[model samples]
Target: MKHLRYVPGLVARGAALAAALAAAGLPLVAAAQDLRGPLGAAPAAPAAPAGPRNMSESVAAVVNDEIISTYDLAQRMRLLIATSGVQPTQENLPQFQREALISLIDERLQLQELRRVEKERKINIVADEEDVDRQLGELAQQSNLRPEAFVTALRGQGINPDTLREQIRAEISWRRWIQGYYGSRLRIGEDQVTLVQQRLAAAASKPQYQVSEVFIDANRVGGMQAATAGAQQLVQQLQQGAPFPAVARQFSAAATAATGGDAGWVSPGEMPPEVDAALEQLRPGQLSAPIPVRDGVYIVYLRDKRGGAGGTLVNLKQAAVALPQGATPGDEAAARVKLEAIRTQATGCNDLEAVAGRAQGVVAGDLGEAEVSDLIPAFQEAANQLQVGQISQPVRSPAGLHVLAVCGKRAAGAAQLDREQIENRLYGQQLSMIARRAMRDLRNSATIETR
Candidate 1:
């Protein structure tokens, strides 16, 4: 099942609820800075933007009775730019606007459907202030900022917290509606769980792929041509640095769209043949083009993979020297010598940071709990050979030399699945299909006007 059920707590994947979802790598703005990627107050006169004029634009889009004004459009753009940390050049702004407009349109459709469902069922699904607060708190945690400070930062960026709240409300409300309506009928027999266990046990030694998904529903289109074109555009935007999770949250018709399209760790047999073939062609951090299937177009991002199923995850730290600009082979050689010396001195995990501090251009920090495949190839190999409290010899990369230490490791296995886990698995599989159909019907009936 698609894992899009996380409430506002998921900032990125954890960010699943936040706008510009999955914005962990993006720096948050300060209380005083206006949304321009860390630039502070300016006394100097601002230069004119050297591009085609987009000023004087009016209402950008309309969904049913709701209007998204030019300011709303601009604010949304600024919010995306601010939170994503992906600066839009003149070259890509038009494309960004197109995708952004599409996303906003989809957001409206989702919220509208949520409202309609509530009215139809005589349910009150409004997101209260407390719900908004919790959502903000989760988003702040992803950026390592306090919730109040995060709110202040967002306001500084001209992004209304209420807009974020509405998004959260929509996410939460729609999920509740799906569960309330279909969850009762969604069931997993004990026999089904046993069958899955037997299959997994048999294939325990085979490779498993950890993946996230972005599905564009072409089946809803009046024509396959238009759907194909829309899917292609999404592929282009993702290639151009749009956050996959954010796009999924805004536009995916799948239920896991709520969790930012996280499908969790899927094995070869679990995935469709078309998807498996596509997965074979990409490595970790790579995305596939739109793979046209019978019902929709799928663009999958490979998170990581392993030779076997779940294994030990380690808490790791690294101490490294950042090579100076224009450093030569001799300079690299000197850095490696220093790293080896540091390696001996930083033999223990606790000593790693201090050893790095003594070296020039060395930056030391934690790598967090992660699997071997989660690291770069060289680091993965070196880590696999090390024991807890053991420090690696200098690992070389273009940036510089590095030494790593393993703080701890823990087992992660298939036995972790309990009855509740099995039920959720069943729920998600059924819910995604139901959610997709519901969204399709909603879109089919909606009156959307684009400028």
Candidate 2:
């Protein structure tokens, strides 16, 4: 019954990846054409190869004895530019290469783990080709092209479509692997949800911010200086024209990076203290300079804000048993009796529609969400009086004898942390943390060499 906007799943994340790239203002193939110059200009030619007869055969990095080839890095770099909407200049080429290489390494590690798991368990954990195709369809649609056409565009840009495909495969596989491994073990108790609810209620009078972020982990990128530099560059790109979500998808190290770095609505103490301070200074639609946290730098984008004490919004559902405009007392009484029967049988809003279906002449559906005060007097009174999932006794409206149910409510500027939402939030946080730790362990034990 809660009108919460749940976090997106794998397919949605994949769609967002393509959507962000498409919305970045870069022409489909122009990104590749302008690697060494501003868009619409000819790119500079590369110098002759130094070592390998086939330059693509040259090694870029070695991950646990597996090689990531120069060709692989180049394709990924182009994909990065295309997806991130960052103008590839000589100044940023090294940075892009580093990012591309790191991404390649992570994918290698993830694939290795998947193979290990499959071998050990004798089960296939890899994402199916159909899943890849579905994700590709979403990506292509975002580019305003059919799947075949989108593939052509990538090829024209000298990008191997398989680069994108493999990236999707790795992400899908890794996500599934993590969720499968940890989901059942993670539990969110009623007490945890209640604690979060209590915290939210306490902060209900403080300001609330709708925030998105780009986090650069100092350890991942090398050190504090490098992370700070990366954060500064990302902030610059965002200020210039790069889409925040697009950049976020490419560079943010936070778990929210999977969903374009959306941190959703947060109160004062919800985020790190430093980030909270930075957010306070930002107006809606403004970007904050990189703020140094203990392990990383954060670039926050304030999407919107509202005072904590805003009006109440309600989600309502209604069942109306119709009668004639000037029906006889018998008719009204009969309608009320029918409605009362339905109400008594209905335990909550979840089953209200089905319960109403049992009786004739009963029309049951949601009245939808609205501010409590904005609802008409009859509905408003009902909404103000009933708690979530509580059904009202039958009352006569102009059209019929009606019973209303309160499905959910929230303060205008706040997000409702319902039981399901809290569980999901905790699940994601733990999963991401575990995944990161797993990757860190792999990195620690593996022999990685860069060329």
For each candidate, give its TM-score against the true structure: 0.59, 0.68
User: How displaced is residue 43 in candidate 1, in Å?
Assistant: 23
Residue pairs whose backbone atoms clash in candidate 1? 4-259, 10-14, 10-15, 10-16, 11-14, 11-15, 12-15, 12-22
The deviation in Å at residue 211 for candidate 1 is: 2.6
- At residue 356, give the lDDT of candidate 1: 83
Clashes of each: 8, 0
* Candidate 2 ranges beyond 4 A from true positions: 1-56, 310-412
Model 2 Cα lDDT, one tens digit per residue, 91-142: 6676777788888888899889899999999998888899899889877988
The model with the greatest lDDT is 2
Q: Over 4 Å off in model 1, which ranges?
A: 1-57, 83-85, 90-95, 110-122, 141-148, 190-205, 219-262, 283-286, 308-420
Q: What is the lDDT of candidate 2?
A: 0.76
Across 340-370, the per-residue lDDT of candidate 1 in tens digits comes to: 8888777688888988888877789998877
